[model samples]
Target: MRSGIHPETRPVVFRDRAADTLFLIRSTAAASKTIVWEDGVTYPLIDVEISSAGHPFCTGTARVVDTAGRIERFQRRYGRPATHRG
Candidate 1:
């Protein structure tokens, strides 16, 4: 509860590139850019590479790699027995 000892907590916008999504929130982080949010007020803008909006799991488009199939193909090409286990 001390004064002048904590970083400034202010409204900020986090933008996700892949999903073209923007969110309004509060943070103590600093940014060099700013943007006007839906509330018609300007706030610091932080550009992020990924967020829940663009995440595969959140979007329900996650892919499961076929490791077993790849191992079988490799064995066939090398004439070796497949030793991979699920």
Candidate 2:
């Protein structure tokens, strides 16, 4: 660690608009807004479109892509590659 080498970090409130959730955590991020937390303390407020609370991967709502099916369709449409002969 060195002096004057790290960004300042403080309690910041991240608001997940999609999930309507608020999380207070220490972060180096900055915001132009502020929010009063549950502890009655005002913190920098940063609004996010998505977070773990609303993300499909975190909420287990993600759909697995059918890569095999897509490959099959592509091959059927274009046929297999031709082998090169010298």
Candidate 3:
């Protein structure tokens, strides 16, 4: 690990737009915008589209992004039917 070569990492607030949530975390990301946190200290603001609060896997509402469709199509093109082994 290098000392001064790495970007400055500090406490930043990540706001999930979709979930309407805010959490403080240490990150290297920076922003000109700032907001006062619960501790009454200002921190850099980072707006995110999605986070664990709104992610499909975390929410258990997975979305099919046509990848499943592609797999189904490939299987239809080259798959064989199961035969009775008994």
Model 2, 1-86: lDDT tens per residue? 99899999999999999999999999999799998988888899999999999999999999999999999999999998899999
What's the number of clashes in each of the models?
Answer: 0, 0, 0
Residue ranges of candidate 2 with Cα displaced over 4 Å: 77-86
Cα shift from native, residue 2, model 2 (Å): 2.6
Which regions of candidate 1 fall more than 4 Å away from where they truly are? 1-6, 81-86
**Higher-scoring candidate on TM-score, 1 or 2:** 2
Across 13-78, the per-residue lDDT of candidate 3 in tens digits comes to: 999999999999999997888999999999999999999999999999997589978988988998
Q: In angstroms, how far off is 2's CA in candidate 1?
A: 5.9
Give the C-alpha miss distance for residue 27 in model 2, angstroms: 0.7
Q: After superposition, how far is residue 29 of candidate 2 from its true place, in Å?
A: 1.0
lDDT (tens digit, per residue) of candidate 1 on 14-48: 99999999998889989999998888999899999
Q: What is the C-alpha lDDT of each candidate?
A: 0.92, 0.96, 0.92
Model number with the top lDDT: 2
TM-score between candidate 3 and the true structure: 0.68
